[model samples]
Target: MLGPVAAWDPDGTPLPLGAPRHREVLGRLLIARNRVVPVGRLVADLWGDEPPAGAVGAVRTFVSALRRALEPGRPPRQPSRLLVTDGPGYVLRAGREAVDAWRFEDIAARAAGASPHAAVALWDEALARWRGPVLADFPTAAWAGAEQARLEALRLDAVERRADSLLATGASRDAVADLRAHVSAHPGREDGWVLLATALDRSGRRGEALESLRRARAALAEGPGGHGPGPALARVEARILSGTGGSAAEPGGMAGGVWDRAAAAWERSVPARSRARLHATAGLLRDLAVTGAEGLGEAREHRRDLVAAAEATGDTELAARIIGSYDVPAVWTRADDPAGAGELSRAAARAAARLGPGGPPALRARLLSVVAVESRGDAAADAPLPRAADSPAAEPWRLRAERAADEAVRLARRLADPALLAFALNGAFMQSFATCGSAARREVLGAELTRLAVGHQLPGHEVLGRLIRLQACAGLGDLAAADAEAEEVDRLATRDERPLAGVFTSWYRALRTCETDGWAAARPRYDALLATAAGSGMPGLSRGAAALVALVPVMRGDGLPGPGLARLDAGPYRPWLDPLLLAASGDAEGARQALAAAPRPPHDLLQEALWCVLARAAAAVGHEPVLRRARDELAAAVGESAGAGGGLVSFGPVARHVRAAGRALGGP
Candidate 1:
């Protein structure tokens, strides 16, 4: 580590760190350094959601304090020491001499090609300088989290690379075991799984390697929940698996290099293109992707290349409106980015508006829908986004995305495409539920959704948010249909790997196990969920997902018949605990009434399913008319779900619930 110097002095006398706010502002600036970090980031990171009313003034005051402290003597030739004021932001000018992290990155990159032993040595030296959470004493500021996550992810990368060097040089078994623990410690990370899988595969544990593949698959499937190795990881896994007797073929091209030759030919043809030539070339590439499974990734790269060419021609606006397609926004909300999340959303909307037509009709529609659902109109969820609609035209991308969604829906309507319209509607529906909490609208739309979606396969390019909302419908006394939809989720989620796959499976299983005795079954699902949740390391969403799922067990059987619901005290769901408590304390009737009166479902299906159980207990108590009404509503739901089947159980616990309710009420 570089010692405190006198001239290039990081420690001439230790400048006053200043007051709390000032310390915070200085901390943010110092962490980011000369990169022009925005003012909004400073404010958001400083105070989060509830920044004080005078946050701007507060920030300026903090900046002034940083200047005074850092410039103990007369000011240097520059604006100030360390923290330099820049356009609409401040830049910290530490360089390598000032920042330990900068030095680590520089040294680590150089070590990338070094010998395994030397590389490990270099990286270990670079890594050892960490105290507690690099900035643990710092508050949970916006920029702080961003920088923290980035640095942590980077450090993890370094660690993995060191392990890789060790593995490659045959010091891997112990190295692999260490990596596996780290990978397990940090689930939903691609490199960890990749390294762990490699280690396990080398140890003659291919079965475990396959399981690691499942972890990678799950992590990747989390849908921007984590940046779990997009296509790059896919390529790596294909290489690994094919080598492990899975038979994927060499990296470049599989079909005797036909696809590679075709890809190269198409790549060459793309640059020197007339309108006619461009169209013809695009057609050839699409046809080629359809020709074989192996060429799809190459075809996608070609697609990106074509889009780039369009950009260079200065007709991007024209290109997007003609060929660009809608895509899912990043799942992170724009609140994730305080300064420009708005502008980012506007640009996305405008571009989507323009390029809303190009891309493959179905693919574009689904892409746009998924992006809308993900971006849900928020930008900061920090998920990877498909490229924006070709950037042309002036549209506002504010934090609120109803407008963007409206635009996407408008585009779908303009095309008069049923699939796209449904696709777009799903996005709008999510926005409505997220923004306005409207269940009736979803119910009305649910019928159309069922009609449009049944037996129809969605295009490969899509998000599963729409499918998730279908679970919401079932929670609203729409059991029969919910059962069918849950079954579909089971099928879809079976292939899911870690996070969402686990969430979906838990939801599906918990819903199917909808009885008093079923709680035991629910335990394993919850255990699986807990494991998945721990693997995720994203507590808010994971715990939130888990807390919501656990509500099912809380309300099953006579609405918390005895002491059965007492064991749910070990979690953090301010939203769910109350209803479970109410049910467990023999307030079954009250719980049912409260749930029915509310008409709103909890964020998790578990809670929604609990509502059903509670309502049944209410019916068993003194509300004959209300009970009959609930039954009738549920019976119609079943008939609606069953279609010509007329209120028969479709085939699951949900079906059983409806049937049990109908028989209890002496209804058809």
Candidate 2:
């Protein structure tokens, strides 16, 4: 009867209720559940405000008919037991469990406090009993409306609870998908957004977490009062910002102070039993904000407490998450410690598996990329830029990382979330850059993402997208485009107050100056850029600037610097440049050997420049074969003109010089 009325005889044969009206009467009585439903109210519900003059008599006739159907063998004068008439109305005698709605509610109430895994099963069973809304076929019936609303509300609560259980079980990705739908349907619920944001952050999509908070605020803004985001929403934003190394500590200290006060309030106000997760989160944020290992110890202690508390609450999923969070630092920082890195990666993978097969692609991609980076070995101090990508065919781990990044891109695109898309695109682009050397694939992706980010007004994404495009352009030997894009990046960075934007763009400027005006002309700019980068306390950019500084002697055709190759071993470019310096110093044979032993050059503007130098040296040494190969490879990498034109300064002059040398040698 929970879904539709089903009456049967003792022998399991169908027993027809007299008519639709008779069934309606029985449904009303069943819904009443042993309580008196006055005839006056029944008449009004069955017929609305307007009713026939004989409505009461008609209702009585239907009730009598229902009684007869229930007790077919009753004596002529016997009173009914199942459907009995009171002074003003009729009542149906039935236990609460006899009604599916009542039973579902009862079970759901009990399951809320049960172990999460068990509760998930229990809630699924309870929710399964509800085929649809209560009395779904009779939507216009007055008695059904209130009950329908009440039942539906309970259903939503059960869904939310089930999602919470999933999250506690380390099924954050699944939880995120469900909560997205839930919030779309019920945007007024702050808890849904909180859960969604936490799940995103846990899945390693920090940008998505902040975007979720913004969505929440936007939803709430459409509410009656038109107020800004609540304190809870702000807390979630603060946590995300802290996790991502964003500016949580605004100038004048007000914003950071507010976040501190809010964290304190949550700790003090939330029940002690429920505060473990909050404490762990706060501690982690503090650890991220503080330099070195100052806050790490305390953060570790909080994570331990959280794991203990989650296990105590029978939430194995939550315990797994706590452990996963504890391993994040090691995952990013353990490249020098392969044993520890492998152990952490394996542990994270196991935890994700417990969340089931379709775990968060973003999280999986992050872990896989970390493994890829570790496998690539330590960054060459001279190679200022991170290895952009690794070929999937290179090694087993590399394949896994590429596949994971691709999957993340697919998933993020399907989600159509700006922040998530940006995150996924960066992963995909990095893979492309590392393996293929910033080809058309990465250039197109970078341009498309930059446009999308601009359209969406996402400052972070815009900065990233612009930088990606600029880098790709530079790699493609399109310095004119790179210069324009660099300017835009600087403008956007200033607008967004993202100073790191200027660091890379400044390096490009120095590169351009050295290529067109020679190293002597660009030396002061490089020096100033290096100083600025170092002062910014950003080690990567500083390393990049230093790498550029090491190239001054090569650009000026002055051979190696006075300090020699050892001091000039600035990064990835050193191997390619050493040979050119050797040739310049009249060691043509030695230069040829160095070029022969050089690593496969990255397909970039700088590499093209090196190829030009190699070609010139090959021509000078009468190595016609080497000269042809260098010329052909350079043309393939940077277009048919040997990377000339397009206002690009670097390779054009070098390529011309090499070609002039070839002509002088009677070589093509």
Candidate 3:
């Protein structure tokens, strides 16, 4: 029986199935399929080492009930035709087709030899017979285990075969969606992941295909060695990466052994699109292995060669894919090669556009986000030499960046994948933080990003999310909450191999320590973290740490640092730093001028700090206009920084600071 057991009389009308015990007896006999079942075995199968007294009598009574039910009009002396007393027990005379399970098995056996489309339909019909588990009402029955396992295997096989047919029909996107659902429901199925990867690659979502392989490898690693991603999964990853055009080493520095195995497999393979990409990737890796800037230089040359080769072969897809994967020139922000970064950004935008809208939504989202980030960086790099409070060219670029982030989030939400959604949210967070005029808006975005990161188990994202919350708390003057967020950052930072999060956490701790304890007490720790950050290769953190290290004396009402610290770019903090430095030097007019020149970003903790410094300077100099400006800015800043979404974060501290400024300025 495929579901609950039932019976019908010869007249094609339903017959009462009887009670649980009666059904159990009937079910056992039906399973034996007319074979003689011994009375001792039936009793054991029914009770399993706990047979009550009169169990045999109970069996006989159940048999009599089934006999009357199966042959309702039989005469008293006539031998039963359905339930027969065979040997010492009973047998239910039923044909093979009388059992739905038997019918399914027969159809499944014959379906394997049919055409792909026909086979899928037959399998669907076979599977539809199963309403639920075998022996639906008897989960604990010992007799159900082996049969349940067999039927479950058949169901999974049918599902896999259906996916195979869909793939053969060129419905790869449909197959990808179906296989993802199957893999989600049955994570231990290696075949499901392999097929999903293939489908993803075929659909032009190569990045996602590689990500699926990584998931498969992680899953397989839980088993014994050699149990992880097999050759098919590995080949898919190699094929995907061959077009990525990232640094020669695998992203996150996957072990050399993985590439070695794939390379070996490719060597034995004939020339194909994937094989050509693999060869190009190998060339890049060889160049990267040369070491130093010379190696980096050679790697760039190799990438160019690959691009040329792809174009020559008329494989514009591979060319566009490779170009899209190039890193935004990070060094441009160092003022070393801003022009180069601009050129690369423009180049990537052009190449990415060639792929058009047919690419997967997630892939398209990634391309948009990358281009936007690069464009913003290019604008920043080209900003005037003077720390001009504001740049006329920055607004449109920031708008473009925000639009790109919004589009990415829209696309990611459409996909309904937690990882991709978190990624999109993270990008939006960065964009808002970079472009928003109000500090409160950035704080709200950061808080939302943190919640998403924590909920999704995204460790790296959690770090960034918590980092923003920490900064928000510190800005709003909520030391306790900031400290708690700091502790969380410390915890999450250890989960990542990169030192980026740790450096940020350490920097925040030093700033909090400097405020509670004196600068002298915080300096040593700041110095240590700065040293670590300098070697961390994360330019933004390294630069920020160094600037903070240089600002300790200035924050203590001393003069600015000479040479090195003076030359360090303060980034967004420059607007605030200029006024603070002018105030420290006792130049009221200069402080007023600097404050006037400061850019008014929508949200910035440093702006509050600057306003406080200016209010004090204005009080001493008796500049009513300057005092009025500081009081207004601080009041608005306090208002915005009040809540977790960027309202006064450290309400108590911010309130006290604003009140003190108001008092000094002769305000309410």
Each model's backbone clash number: 25, 9, 16
Candidate 1 vs candidate 2: the lDDT winner is 2
On lDDT, who's better, 2 or 3?
Answer: 3
- Per-residue alpha-carbon lDDT of candidate 3 for residues 1-668, written as tens digits (9 for 90 to 100): 56677677656698887998888787777667567899998999998899999999989998998888878899997999878887888888776566777777767765654556686688778878787766667667787677777777787766766666655555568778878888887776666776777677667787788788888888776745445555555654665677642222222122333465467656666466663664567456443622333444455446555545555655545555554444222211222233543444455455557767777676666656554544533333334332223332345545665777788788877775555666566556545544212455655766776787655455556666676667766665667877787788776545343244555566667766777776778778777875665455444334444554565544344233345554666654465556655565667688768755554433223445445545555555465565666566556555433222221111223455566656766667
Q: How do these models rank on TM-score, best leading?
A: 3, 2, 1
Cα lDDT tens digits, model 2, 1-668, are: 35555456668676678777787777777777567899998898789899999999999898888778877888998998878777787788765565677778778865764667898888888888887667766767777777677778788878877776776777677778888998998897666676778778777888888888889889978965565455666766676777642221221122343466457757766776664654467446434422323243344335434445544655545644443333222111113333443443444344555655465554544433333332322221123322211111243444554675566577667655565566556546544534223345656887887887765555556766677667666655676887888888877666445554565677678767866687678778877876665454333224333644554454435233344544543444566566666776788889778766665444333445555656655666666655666655544443322322111224444445445555745776
Residues forming the 10-long window of minimal summed lDDT in candidate 3: 327-336
Better of 1 and 3 by TM-score: 3
Runs in model 2 deviating more than 4 A are 1-253, 266-357, 360-398, 434-440, 474-484, 514-520, 536-538, 544-547, 550-566, 569-574, 580-598, 602-633, 640-667
User: CA lDDT of each candidate?
Assistant: 0.50, 0.59, 0.59
lDDT of 1 by residue, 68-137 (tens): 6666664555567567777888877765645666677667765664666787788777776554465665
Best candidate (score: lDDT): 3
Location of the lowest summed lDDT over 10 successive residues in candidate 2: 327-336
